[model samples]
Target: MNTRIAALAALFLAAPALAEAPAMTVMPSPGCGCCHAWADLARAEGYDVSIRETDVAALKDDLGITPGHRSCHTALVGGYVLEGHVPFDAVARLLAAQPAIAGLAVPGMPSGSPGMGDDPDARYDVIAFGGTAGAGEVFHEAGR
Candidate 1:
């Protein structure tokens, strides 16, 4: 085999075993009941979740999420921001794809979003927000 081609083959062979799954850090207000509920849901799904209370506004700023894109909570997973009531399944998909996105946000207290509990007829959007306020696209939209 050509030396350069053999070296390339070796590198490719070793890549898969070194890959690591992405993890997210969840930050929520201490007294927020819904946040805890969301945390529980994440835990049940095998995510490495760490809970802490901090100034949400400051956290948002630290993550570079301006006021227009801010939500009730903040999460950091694999260089992605999980703002607000994002569901575990969607989060898993996000981590799996590892898209070029600033973060995933549910925005506001959506009636049936994860921790908010089940809604027989709830509609919400799992929006992917990027660098600016309008740099957002719908990843998932829940419906009745």
Candidate 2:
């Protein structure tokens, strides 16, 4: 009985570490400062982020990210794609829900969006795209 209790305690203690977020691979365009900033923000949020500099245009094309859904950087995490300066909350929701979509996008670099700038009143939309018919839909709205 004491051995079983010890094992249970060990499992409980290790649960939190096991629940840590999966590692993320971020592909950013060469010479893009904002992309690096965004990766830093993601790291601050406790995500294991790895940055890989590459030709973003070709990468976007290969990933099926349409022009309208393009962003300066792209990330792959938990089998989902993230484009641009996507907020941490939105990414959290996507991971939790595990929606049947190709990924999420923030489109252009909004003023207050993550890695863009600190504008309290900036507003932007995170778009979910490439599910069934490959249409884009509003996934989340950020800022004021």
> How many Å off is the CA of 41 in candidate 2?
0.3
Rate residue 44 of model 1 by lDDT.
75
What TM-score would every model get versus the actual structure? 0.75, 0.82
Q: What is the lDDT of residue 101 in candidate 1?
A: 68
Q: After superposition, how far is residue 136 of candidate 1 from its true place, in Å?
A: 0.8
Which 10-residue span in candidate 1 carries the lowest summed lDDT? Answer: 9-18
lDDT string for model 1 (1-144, tens) is 223323422432332221243344567876788887887777676665666567778667656666766667787665567888887667777767767667788888788887887563578888877744334888867762
- 87-107: candidate 2 lDDT, tens digit per residue: 989999988887778788999
C-alpha RMSD of candidate 1: 9.9
Off-target runs (Cα >4 Å) in candidate 1 are 1-22, 131-134
Pairs clashing within candidate 1: 24-77, 25-76
